[model samples]
Target chain A: MSAMGDSGYRSLVDPEGGIVDRSIFVDDQIFNDEQEAVFTRAWLFVAHETQIPNPGDFFVSRMGTESVIVSRDRESKIHVFLNSCRHRGMKVCRYDEGNTTSFTCPYHAWQYGSDGRLLGVPQNLTLYPDLDKSQWPLVEVPQMENYKGSIWATWDADAPPFLDYLGDAKLHLDLTLDGRDGSEGGSEIIAGVHKWIIPCNWKFPAENFLGDTYHNISHESVDLIGIGPSAAAGQKGRRDADIAEYQHVWAAFEGGHGVHSALRPAELGYQPTFRDHPAVEEYYRKCFESREKRLGDAARLVPFVGTLFPNTSYHGGQPRALCVWHPHGPTSTEVWRFFLVDADAPDEVKELLRKYYMRYSGPAGMTEQDDMENWNYATAGSMGPVARRHPFNYQQSMHASSWEGPVAGQVSTQISEQNPRRYYEAWAAYMDGQSWDQIYSLGQQARGNGR
Target chain B: MNQLPRTSAFFALQAEVADVLSTEAHLLDDRQYNEWLDFLAEDIVYFVPMQRNVEVGTHAERETTREGKDMHWFEDDKWTLTKRVEQILTGVHWAEEPYSRVTHLTTNTQIVTAEPSVDDATIVEARSRFIVYQNRVEYEEYYFVGKRTDTLRRVDTEIGWELVRRDVTLDQNVLLAKNLTVFL
Candidate 1:
């Protein structure tokens, strides 16, 4: 294996650090290299277990560039397999989602069971009497794991265990995925997936969700329109006094994962925060009590948004939205948005949350409309020769961070680029063709150096 | 589910209904959204249900239930529709700042049910197929094809019809457009 040269790769990111070359967004060679070095080896999110609740239930999902079927077998074991035929490499199952006992290839009529075992092939005895049927099965994803109902898989057989891969990010993920006490069923993805295309590199959205509070200014129009209290207040011009009062925290974890969150003050009286609906408010109050008992002081903080390394992201609070930025190529991405709600919540609250989700974060949503336009233009501008030569700055609040909080990872204020700096550092590590062990160690060393 | 025969009276009513639909389409395609809002009844429920593929024995009941068990793309009442129109009309909506050029092609109009002797004598349920072509910026173009079920009520003799309810079901499981800023 040819490792990336220090000069060639290190030049793409600033040698002194906290700056990134624009070429990474539009370079064809770098994009192809990422498919092999990052996507194939990384643990990527596939589907939630609740999405395929029963035996034979399946959902077609994409991991990087390869399409896979996330399904449950007769014995209720979840499996992920490449949705390709063994004979000639055609997609065996074409629908986005469905339940079936077997998948039959359209072109050659080759059949495979829900367990991905080859059940039949056309003219098996006539064409080749000695051909072994046991040797042919749909290519299985090498490793799979379920954590709090969210399913994840990796093509690399040697990838670390999912929990270890999560590291301290597991604490924040549990806040959204694990719900309240004995109601361990947690949150379930609502029935539909909102998918749409964007003419931008996948990293723009992924990095934004990871930590890009600076772009909140782009959402000023949403505030002018008076959509929500948070939108109306505007994140700009907040004094250090306000930051301390709100208890705003931006924490970056190991393995490039991080969260930016702040407590929505009670005096703000945000409607979706349960101030408008008493019943829903009462339910959440108890839920928060249970969470406080479980997570201690950390439960008091409300997570606004966070990213899980390479692609998947989640936004907590009302009308919760989880997203996966599926990379199409160097210049485009296919965004899959899933809305989630607590399974135990009342039907009316669920309906209210669904409507709120459609209005705020769906493809045609008010707030997201602003984000898409910015990303689309930003990605397009990178194609210019002069533009690609310059590097983007990520030096905001670089030296201002402390580990004093009870929360895990390197902590900073809500408005800072330290999180994105950490993200690109990880990206550079992967691009350097470092092994997972090396990458893990790099994170530790960076943590020791502090933000 | 009574299918009305193609009598002269039915033919006249069908043409009038088609004209009403055409006028509404023209208003939307021309971006006369406030005028388009006037064509809707005060109690209108405009909904677009989410589509899904399921097994042979299973039914994707996104439209059948009212308890919000199933997800939908849009479930707007008159007030919500008005709010959406207000949002679009605001000059700051970046997604629509350039303003997409839209063309709505509606065809295959049929009256599914008509009861001429009732109190609301001219009330009818109609269905139509629509294909909306939307172009934004210099390079992006989107084609959205869907079938719409509508409830039309003849409000007065001078004004032909007003849409009281509409349910649009799109064919694509995953919408390929950047944003669904245009109406179906």
Candidate 2:
């Protein structure tokens, strides 16, 4: 609606006043512009390498609205390529996931190698003799990285490297992907993926995951009826009561990433989780003791939830998983959730965790069911012209956040909107076509959006 | 499925199975959640698995996620299922707080197999199709179409049969609906 680029973004998003215009969630033009501005430049999380362990294994994944094939080539090198055939626009491979040496487009007999090389035409010599196979390989992403067994790619060649894009956010994410015993990265996806659709803006879930402690009321229902692992043992809460002993930290990073982690007051002790099964209880107790011993005080920062800038989100503890809010439209999101567990954990530990993961996440999940309902209607409520006139408030504990706080970036002890405010500030920078220098070096004083 | 012997007792057993399904649909649609719980046995296992797209021949083995071994939409037992009902009845489960108007349209009833004989069946394998339509909060609506394979146990109570196990094959790879707050 408004002119885009440099000046237009400031009108919609004002991180200083701690206010954001509602159009960002419902407008079609702005949503369309985001595909090129935000989605293309950001390092998006594709399939984890563990999903396709051997050669020729492929998984269909999404970057934004477009589909991409994440395949392990014949040489076992991972590649993220556009799923479309170079000749026509048909999808090269239709299956969600499988092992294939090469993909054959159903529309035409055009075959491609797992490395995305255009291998054979229907009639290579006769049909088009001048067509060079080297010229028409599937459009590959310009930049790619495998950080902690997870794959991330970006279309922008000028974009910063994946770790630099992650910056301070990597430490928070390692707690999710690393093994419970303080191993660097031993987590792997479970056998299946929970994919579903939700009628809401992508940012609704993204912002929710980025340290929104204010919306705990959204999950009051699941909280009332305990669905935690220890719920069967007369616990009346949505998660383990062990978190109650620690101080909650809402950590924000300059690269638009933020996390809700916890800090123990003093020395850590074994927290009684998985009380229903003694084997599971014992397994976790050993993990906790070893993690405490290995990482020393570093293990005190237990991860709760986090969002990596533009789209990816993760639930580190409880329902351990990663979610990518793939945008379908301004008001529709195709959510893909991948459950994670230690690849070498005991069968009992993996079994109980998988069962608890299903009960806590996805469309049918008890805790996440209410979340979808809230996000769905919230998108609808913001669609009308009458609602767009008034701006949404983000000024919770405006100056209460500290830049020199313990964890990373800006830190807030009690519940605060400091993370979301800074998150939007960085989002607006991207929408304005800011350079990587501006996006990563957003050094501000109390989130006032000052240079 | 082998052709069932069309005896008079078999016909009578068919009627009893159909009534059990039809009655349970009414109890759920009428917002009588507490009463609907009566239809389930104490050890009922309700599972809804996520579907995946694989090669045709592998459909039987790898199409749907495993019941106890993989991630699924639901792998709930009696305790977890009861908690779901309790959440809706809490009047604060915002997903169903105002309560969506849902209808369980079940059809294609077939009695696959029965224990002992159809004449004196204690446990029966029943198959049917379901199209659960839910309309909520003004303009929100979704159609959940699926197949249900249920194991029903004959009881001496007024309800006639209780559902011991229900395996729902939702005809969706990626679930089209947002939240499955309403039962399928």
Top-TM-score candidate index: 2
The DockQ leader among the candidates is 2
DockQ of 2: 0.85
Per-candidate TM-scores read: 0.91, 0.97
lDDT of each: 0.76, 0.88
Per-residue alpha-carbon lDDT of candidate 1 for residues A167-197, written as tens digits (9 for 90 to 100):
8788667766766442454788887787778
All candidates: DockQ? 0.49, 0.85
Please, what are the lDDT tens digits per residue for candidate 1 over residues B1-184? 5576667777777777788889899999988898888888899888887666554555643222232455566777675577567777777677877787999999998877776733334778889999999898888788999899899887763356778999897887766767778888
What stretches of model 1 exceed 4 Å from their correct place?
A1-8, A180-185, A227-245, A263-272, A293-296, A448-450, B53-67, B116-122, B156-160
By summed lDDT, which 10 consecutive residues of candidate 2 chain A come out lowest? A442-451
**How good is the docking of model 1, by CAPRI class?**
medium
> Per-residue CA lDDT of candidate 2, range A1-451, in tens?
3346546686787776889999999999889988988999998999888899999999999999999999999999999999999989799988898888898888887899999998999978988999989999989999989888889999999988888888888898999999988878999998889899999999999999998888888888888999888898888878778788888988788778989999877765777888888898888889888998899888888889999989999999888899999999999999999999999899889988988888789998888988998999989999999999988999987777776777877888888887787788888788888888888777454356431
- The regions of model 2 sitting more than 4 angstroms off are A444-451
